[model samples]
Target: MKKIIRGWVLVFIFYMSMGTVYGTNTEALMTEKAFINELLKVSKTGAVLLTGSDEILTREKAATLIVNYLGYEAIAKKQNNLFKDVTSSQGEISLVSQLGLMNGLGSGLFQPNGKVTVSQGSLIINRIKNKLETPITWKHAFYAIQSSSQKEWIKGYDAISFGWSQLERDANNNFIISTSNTENDFKVPVGFEGPIDLAKANGVETYLMVYFENKGMLAKSFLEDELQRASVINQLVSLSQGMTKDGVTRAFDGVTIDFEQFLSSDLKELYNIFIKELKSALQKEGKKLNVAVQPTLYFKGYDYKGIGEAADHIILMAHDYGAITLTEVERQAGITTTPLTPIKEVYDALYEAGLSISDKSKIALQFSFASLQWQSQNNQVINSRAYTPSYDKIEARLSLSGSMKHFDHYLQSTYATYEENGIQNIIWYEDINSIHSKIDLAKLMGITSVSYWRLGIIPEAFNPLR
Candidate 1:
């Protein structure tokens, strides 16, 4: 009877141990399932992972499903030890394919028998966040998840906590934030959506994305709205930059006169009258009545002193050292003969005019990348005319000038250089090489800032200032 009791007791103990092991395994599976459910919920709008009827999955199967649904090629490559070799050429493509994100590929690769590491999960989640395009609602939710992911280097319970933190950060970053109540009174819409779309339209999507990431969700929205408002304000301000409107009178481009010729007595009177009107118009627009006057003209013979004294900011037209004309010879000399008459001449003239510009910050330096060319024939100057030369022709001319010693040094020097004349030809105007020089000059001059002759006329590189 005692032997029988011992056998029964041993059996009971064995069963209890087995039951404990099973319960632990069950709990682990439940935790993993819950984590995956969160991912699925977040991805509801576009792509989502499938769950089974029991809604419970094995560890291996759960990892496989994540790898499959996300199209995580990296995991596969890592599993096969193929990443080191394949990553160079086909890595990005493979990774995107594995994420189930390759458009039109129809959801490839969902494995069921693989375990997922915390690092792998974080990488996958981050990629999903990046793939989401603009007008991204719930952006804050993604941010919260990212924060959790970042702190996931710790193992076990700490990893779980980090993941939860990430989710929280994402939620706060996205849905909970509110936009400002201030109305953007501009004619066009102003908000995160508008600015994001505009950036995309302008082929500056990358810049916008960077700006968005750096500023966080709320800040990005505010900045985008402010930029849009500022753009509208800038347009209105620009209209008043060189405009005169009083009663029925309207003038633009510094032109003010009746049908009479320029600078006539009627023109001067009209200019004075228009200036007063411009001031009034600007005041109404809530902009300073800033006028861009020729620095030389303002100081030359004191004719423009009164107007310069009355102006808010004197925008010195320090560029246009060379002007385009139809005369052939003037087009080939390279450097402008009227150099001293404009930039250097005008800058000095402004100083001589005795106009006390208190704020040097208001002065803007205008510079150009285009150079003049003076063409000569038989030792005599040719008329102003433009000649469009192909690369081959330019190359040939350069070679000839280099070989020939007796040719005019100026012509030789000019021939050695090339320009795209951005104002006329929309080709290569200030390349990266020339832009460095311009930036250096601007820095050296201690000028308030530099302004382009025309915004649209310059290369995209010039948009940095804007």
Candidate 2:
């Protein structure tokens, strides 16, 4: 029912926008009236007085109308002059131009007094409407910097988290550093800092991701022990202060905690306290804190409200839905494929989190680039076993069996089934289209930040710069 209302609202908005630039006729005047009335009904802050449809709109007026319609009038009023030709509406001109809603005439001239054509007026109105619908203006990336093209994608993100550190505990339950997968001696590798420098130079914030990906995760115990948690927090704060690179000490803007242990709801308070203390510690060192959290759809341990208030950002790892949560009966009955990140599941997770976390801006939705494959024999899933296959391997499997990919509208994902010898392999993964669909949903929900799982596995054509 809510979706039906939303659809009608979109249709109404489109109808109203068409009246913004109507012909100078009695019918056009009626449409202009309807537009104004509809705009007033939808606008939270009262209606804006738009010029009559017959009146010629100047570029300055068009920009002002756009900024005002989007409720960015205050922000526009604060902008300084970007064009010498305009002064009275310079702020509006600058604001709209910066937002890509309008543009200058050329050669540092805004031509503020120039007439706005009907097409130009309609375009500006549509752009403003789009901005109001999806206000995403920032992006985040979880990077490994494994390939050269991976580094190239760095230009697209507002921030990047590199897995440069690992957290561990010794026999005494004391905090310690483990040898990083990317480098030995638990140090940032040489030449690896180049991406850091490049990211920083591009005005992109950098974060050191402190990971605990042990097969038998010791993180739960370490976090449960207050003393050990404090010790780890101190270590993380120190790392955030700076790392040695090329004879100079450079610091990341923040630290990201990626502890992969499943914390049950019983530990929710403890986990919230841990996050608060870690954030407080990092704050003392002038660094920010980011926590990667499993989606509440699967894990009820995370206190979204508490964590949202304490940390600068909380990345909801929204993938892996239905990956291993199959029932015994279903396993025996045989399954063709399981969705990795079902759209409805992701929606439910976000909606549940929104109930507790009032500030959605602090939330970053995660998208995975990996694929999960399951083996089937005799029309039954074998042991219900599933494993992640590389992109190349998935492609080769498809090529070998000549299996075509099918789009599952229900899941908003793509899947393929292939025969390997006598066994059937079913693969489910995100493609460019699926990722874009998720992104569209995220933006429609007013989410501004999105984080990729990692760099190398993402498609070559994927662009994060939107």
Candidate 3:
């Protein structure tokens, strides 16, 4: 009996040092030994064994987890320029940088102590998952990328998004050329910002969504006559043809219809025909077709089944819930602040659209990085037009230093409020933590893929996991 007890004690020590013990019967023993072990303990899932008081993850902690927990010692062995003020997390930060999973904030500063946001955290985890290259064997991955406003980026409303906008500034800080959202006809200028990069799309299939800026007028013209609709279809075919210009090809594997205009059921049929025709056209050229759909609750008149059958990938754009408070109709409903995209509501709507879990393998949950801003007086919000700043620009302008950051447990969003004058300002937007929460919800719903609405708003490293 004495010899057996001594052997168990030795096993506990080995387990503490090993950190990750996946052997049979050992898991139960590890749990019992955890009560005695003080240096380190194993995770309930047996996926990780973290040190005491290191429950919170940092860059260094992440590195250790990757090495010890995930057995990524080869990546963990590599190191970059270590900071003078940093005594820990160097290996993790270096491993992250070496794999292109994370980048420094300029000047070789890793800021290891800084907390990682949902976007950054999601990016890292996704990259790790990709690096592992584990076979899903069940769910298929669907990706969605959107081509949105050029002005939002050129005007600096979004810091990161401007990088993807393709609008460059001269040495004097002036736009090399001009772009406008007022054009009725769609045209990509010389080397104009297209959609997100498809080359680094990794393994999962992706769709490049082109924004029909003048969709309202196009819908109006199509409604007037069938010939006009045909003409519109011709123009769309021409836009897809534009992708092959200047001897460059394979920019996008598929073309996504990002029309958000108000379409009647009749127009929806016409649009369906348009999509079918577009899919046929792309098929002729050995390409694919995809689409960005509106949330079922907000946008009516869409034949979800018809569109779903026609498109190779369907992206459910379920953002803008928080915009209700700023809308003309919802302000009358006496609503205040809310999440930009509530989790359960989005999932319920998508699932009810008749797409089963298996069918959703090619379906994406589209997310937005913009925030809703409004002023409040006497605890009542002031009515305003659409006003949202990109996550980066807002972070640069107002930080959590003077403001209070609150997480909505029910909605899974991050909001910040600060006072510039006597008026109170409330802004709710997506962040790293909130993004992870949403992704968690998607994973729980058996979703295989998710998407960002636009490029450059979120870090390029923060690619969604398939």
Candidate 4:
């Protein structure tokens, strides 16, 4: 059964995003004990959250029941009372103490019943991550940054104007990054001219990101062994560092690695090592380094603290707050085609991420303005596609689809239904209102910089001076 905890996630995504841009096949690629620590941390607040499980764990005793699941031999061998106040069952306090993942404050008074502080929580997680097995093989140079067809440029607005209409003239001196291909293997194809032309024509920078996926994976295998992994990343960095020399790229300009939703927890150490090493190499060449990662997963013990500290800028891919369903199972479970980037969803996800990630100055929340098109039969969706309708296209569709203009105040996005020959078509899209939500979200989060997926989707009128 799908864990359809609909409406549980309010800060943005952290909502159940169950499908693709219309269930397009995409392969990809996270740890365990640290999760218990998170639950323990959350339990301290006494905030009872109801998921599917009926037990609301606000008490430490209930939280300690998970320690027996660790299956440690030392747990059974315990014959001594380590603390006077410890009351957890299954020898959890003993095992945690033996593992050196936790400690007492003073005089052998183990605060098993006490609330976990940030420092204590960090120590526990770091200890667990440090012991994770690592014997990974370096992936061979099997992938290349191959370009695909250029995005259809809308006339009159130009590429830059399509990004955000409120964008000042000075902001156009920066790069506008977007992905290409079938959403599986995001690579830099041959002669796809968006960032390059902008870089050459306006002296803006171009950051060509390259990645591959087998349904979210690191080259179809877990990439471990930091030394060998560094070699592979070094090659990619080596190519990227000198990749855009012909475009007259300026300082604080280089490749932005958009490899989010692909890395597993066991591979995070290697991933961090790769970024740290890559940043070092890029810095030596006076090139800037930026990495794109999801804020929700960053808290799952994936080592954002290391990556954020290493990269020049961290592009928080904060969009995709909700999801569009594709499969029969998802649709059957009350999955609706909703906003691509709901403002409240973003705020909630970011709020959770902000608990772990420091230094908001380095973050540039990547705002999205896209929607999904679904065609349903007998109240069930049969097929769907990611539809990014331009202003004129939206107008034509509205006239063709219907004029009700239904709005989801929670999502802060609009959707409409129309009957084309008695077939129901649902079009959920972004308008100027979506952009306003994004601008408000950025300010609320105390973030400064913002990046658009492509320079031509929305328009320049919405982008404010910054």
Candidate 5:
């Protein structure tokens, strides 16, 4: 009788050590059922491990399911041992940990046979599905500040490009220029002087943005004429030297060439020559040149290699791929909605830019802090407009309409839809998640700088740098 009792005690201890706990609540059971169903659909190993919805899953088995679903079972099995306590499932544990899919407990203990909690399961699932990473570290930030607002949002940044300096042509097409204000001196807008002082006070660099408007005609003509181009370059160099006021030295650190015209390959050489000459002039006065170019996928007028070598920073306007218009092929295929900056498009742009600009440090991936509203009917877009909405505005709109935002896995964008007055309204907007994902992608590609289209549109709360 003594020997039999001792044997029963040992058996009880062994069973308790297995950590076999059951999920008691209805929600837990349903979640477990759904998880098991998903696993069973993907992997055959679910047949042996997933017994019932109420049964708790061991951490080791959870790791195995993730590995199998990710098609990493064979590779997992080939890995060497990671944890000493995890003898049978060492390969799976090692693989998941290395891929950042899972982590071990303290003291080198993975608790392979321990019960997996609901939080752990949910986090692991999100890691595999969303491909999340820790917060990224960026070296520099370039912001586009609108001078009209006069609201200061340039607290912490490496540099800022601001102004509404528009390029125009007189009757003789003599390459005239103007600002957004009535009283403009040296092409400098009225309200921007204060911001330049603020930027200097905060130890942030400033760049006067030279806007090219009315398509590429004015800019192209200016570039074609050697004498006209020289005059404009000299004017820009003089503008870089800011005037002093009340014992204050206000000067721009550089000038940003925001030429967004539809120039073809024929103008590529002319573009390069203009940029080289401007860069040389700026360098003479201890200033820099920042060239904002359209993505390689859209325009071929930008000589990436030439500009990359001459300019201090090459800002890639990676947004607005399908913001305002869609191609004919897309219309025929019954596609209407488009994200402003898709993840794949950004990646492709970065890849193409990398091909020419070997120095990734000079590259700054620029995105919009705005949103696009698309009006569609019968799977055809009727009209679309882009606007910058504050965070409070977005939340208020969603709350009033009782609409929920949905995230796209492929595009890495957040969007919402609603029907009002018998018309469909689709909004593709930028939130913290969408913005951070792109920033992480840039970090992964070894690019450390990022720029926003303009400020005062996005509220101070949603500032990406913070």
Candidate 6:
């Protein structure tokens, strides 16, 4: 049975190769424990179990095996304690409870003696590909596995083998894998290459030291970089969260407070402090300090007016016309009304606050590539539920026949609506269709510059920022 299964797998690979599906090189060496650890890191739910094998190798067992083999006995014990803490706190079982790669199997019960099936192996690899925060690189390659005659004749065996064989390729494509395997090995590989050469090649042994700076898991370095600027903005707003926009704007204008006191009462004070330190550090690194302030309409009637005096440019958040509440006309038109009023309001408030925001060229109007769904029953606000309109929901609502056609129409219609509504400044969320529409719209609107809500959320396709 096993021989027959292996034969079928071989045939499938042959067919795949002929079909030009087998392309990536799979010969990169990675340790089993590292591979498993990565898999757990990338799993969507933080839990991945070994499947495809006849024997059940739970996540717990896999983790235990990794800890024991890696000689992390003390760390393993700590992991067990962490697991207990997480389980007790969450009142649910989560893969994060276990510190090791295979979940929380513990020190003594990893069950390395059990056989792994093809399905189980695929699940593990897939989890790794999905969960790792770092990038991976994938190279296509043909894979073949030999099965013994005594093994069960399972169709899934070929599927599983093919699946595991693709892990290296997937990781490589994402720029995560330092190596891959073209041939089979019972052991795992280690030390895969990363996209960021400084960190990947710097011999930085610990993720904690390189990124978190000893704060450990309590601080998320990746998120910090991505959100630091936004955090500063949020902090500024939060400092006067309870005050009316007009009052806050006024306060910002005349308040004789230092930068520290400026951010003292905000929920995001730490972020503001971090930004100050970051600016100093960047200056030392020979980077210029360019700060841009984008004011929202919520500050129209607030205290601080001359807020843009300290920065390079003042961006006006010109969208969100339909944010607080939408009118019946907006609902029928399938778009927000003119955002000009709010934009002008914010501009006026900035001027009133005494910011030296010069000509219009220094101010850019921000637009939205996304839309909101107003949940209304019979045209009257039904419970005032609003949702971000997604492609799938828009298609379903329009009863479009196919995803491609629906997406095409949706993109065209959305862009037209924005243009027709006379929205000049725009910033798009990180989405392919939205980005494409913004490009086309920019050409139509004759706008020269655009910005993104974030750099991280932007897809790899737009990484070059053409």
Report, for every candidate in turn, its global Cα lDDT versus the true structure: 0.33, 0.70, 0.51, 0.48, 0.67, 0.30
| TM-score winner | 2
lDDT score, candidate 2, position 257: 81
Query: Candidate 2: TM-score?
Result: 0.66
* Superior candidate under lDDT, 1 versus 4: 4
| Candidate 6 TM-score versus the reference | 0.28
- Candidate 3 or 5, higher lDDT? 5
Give the per-residue lDDT digits (tens) of candidate 1, residues 1-466: 9999999889767654333234433112233555466557543221335554434343334444444444333324433211322323233334344333321122443232233344444455455444432221100000111222222111111001000100011333332111121231111112223322333344321110000111223322322343443442343344323222232211111111011112222234434444455444556654444344444443231224444544444445444433456344444443334321231233343343334455544444444444434444443335453333433344354465322211111111122332222222111123333333322222223333443333223334433423
Tell me each candidate's TM-score: 0.31, 0.66, 0.55, 0.53, 0.65, 0.28
lDDT of 5 by residue, 1-466 (tens): 9999999888766655443434522122124455565555432111233434555677787777665554345456557777867987788788677656688886778888776666667667666544423333322333334434523566556788865465666577687555533544225544446777777888778887887743636557778899988888887888778643454546788888888854477668989999999999999999999998887666878888999999988988888765555566654454556787776677667767777898878998887666777666776665534444555666667886656787665466677777766666677877766766666556545676788767656655555346
The digit string of per-residue lDDT tens for model 3 on 1-466 reads 9999999899887764434244632321222122213212321111234443423345555445544443234334445445554577666566556545566676757766554333445556566555334222222222222334332232221111111111222365432121222232233333432332322223333333445422444454544455544554454455444444355443434566666744455566766776787788778776677677776665664667778887776767777776543564454443556778665566555554435324656566777777877776656566655457767667775655667777665455678878766767777888776665555444434554565655445543344331
List pairs with backbone clashes in candidate 2: none
Give the root-mean-square deviation of each candidate in angstroms.
27.4, 15.1, 16.2, 19.7, 11.1, 29.1
Model 6 lowest lDDT segment of ten = 205-214
RMSD of 5: 11.1
Instruction: Please report, as a residue range, the 10-residue window in candidate 4 with the lowest summed lDDT.
Output: 160-169
Considering every candidate listed, which one attains the maximal lDDT?
2
* Superposed Cα deviation of residue 319, candidate 1 (Å): 2.4
Ranking by TM-score: 2, 5, 3, 4, 1, 6
